[model samples]
Target: MPNINILTVDDSVSMRLLLRAALTKEGHQINEAEDGVAAAEWLEHHQPDLVITDINMPRMDGFGLIEHIRAQPRFRDMPILVLTTESTAEKKARARAAGATGWIVKPFDPDQLNSVIRRVAH
Candidate 1:
């Protein structure tokens, strides 16, 4: 697969680190953000191939970020994957409604994550 640039957002420092290590190992460029607010700032200056964000974050939850990104014409079709612990059908439906391209529950496997990124990164 070609090199993919990924922006990963999560409130946990540990989770971000893990994702960084894993995705970097897969040869993808990763930009880490502690929350939606930080991710939004990064998004304004840089456009990644995909966004992997977690819900229930402070400052601006994943849902808010998805809506914000979707509102901007430039990012309307960008692929966004909700990488959170919430697995309820309701949450999934809401994420889809907000323009998420896919969903991956937390505690994600490194291989699966990389595979999913490849699939959605296009």
Candidate 2:
């Protein structure tokens, strides 16, 4: 797998740690944010190959963050993946509408997550 830069956003510290360990082990550069608000701040100064975000967060949610990213012309085509516990069709449709590139349910497998990053970042 290519060494891609990725932003992993989640409210849970454990989730962020897990993602960092998994991605770093695959030689991918990983940046982390505890919530959507922090992720937004991070995005201000950095551009990553992909963004993986959780749906439920303080200040902003994944859907809201997707809208924010899509609204900006420079980030309009940036790949965004929603990694959340919710798997409802309605939520998926909403995320797609908000410009999410893909959706992955929470408790994600490391290999599957890396595979998705490869596919989307390509």
Candidate 3:
């Protein structure tokens, strides 16, 4: 597997910690942000191999972040996995339309998270 750098954006500190731990255990270097705005700021200085963001966040939501990333030429093709408590079909549809590479419903399982990352991080 390649050495992966992942940026995880979520408002919940515990969620971010959990994701960081899981990803780190899988040998990924993880960068964390409390919200989409912070994630965007971090992206300005660093480009991670992948982005994993929560759909619900203060300042900017996952869809907004996806739009922001897509608007940037440098990050246009960056893979993004949206994590959300929302499992509605409409929500998933919106996510796909926003250019998210995949979706992970909240309270994600560590093994499943790793699997998704490995599958999407190419």
Candidate 4:
């Protein structure tokens, strides 16, 4: 797959670092934000091929971010993947309703994550 730009939103510094390392290894450029608020601010100036976000976060959660992104015409079609430890059906449904393109449980497998990224981002 061709290299793509990706924005990852999560509160954990280690999670962001892990994602950056894994995605960067696949030749994808990774940008990170500590929370949805930061991600939204970043989105104001930059557009990435895909976005991976955790569901629960301080100062605007993933759902809010997804809704915010969808409200903008420019980012309506951007692929958004929810990556969180929550795997409840309710949460997944809510995320889908919020305009998430897909969901992946936390402690994700790098290969599977990259595969999903390729499928949705391409």
Clashes found in each candidate (C-alpha, N, C closer than 3 A): 0, 0, 0, 0
CA shift at 68, candidate 3, in angstroms? 0.4
lDDT of 3 at 7: 94
Off by over 4 Å in 4: none
Per-residue CA lDDT of model 1 for 1-122, tens digit only, reads 99888999999999999999989998999999999999999999998889999999999999999999999898976899999999999999999999999999978999998888888777
Per-residue lDDT over 17-114 for candidate 2, one digit per residue giving the tens place of the 0 to 100 score = 98898899899989998888899899988888889999999899888888988888888778999999999999999999999999999889999988
Model 4 CA RMSD to the hidden true structure, in angstroms: 0.7
Candidate 4: residue pairs that collide: none
Q: Where in model 3 is the C-alpha error above 4 Å? A: none
User: What's the TM-score of each model vs. the native?
Assistant: 0.96, 0.96, 0.96, 0.98
- Model 3 TM-score, all chains together: 0.96
Residue 114 error for model 4, in Å? 0.3
Q: After superposing candidate 2, which stretches have Cα over 4 Å from the reference? A: none
Model 2: colliding residue pairs: none
Candidate 1 or 4, higher lDDT? 4
The digit string of per-residue lDDT tens for model 3 on 87-115 reads: 99998999899889998897789999899
Candidate 3, overall lDDT? Answer: 0.90
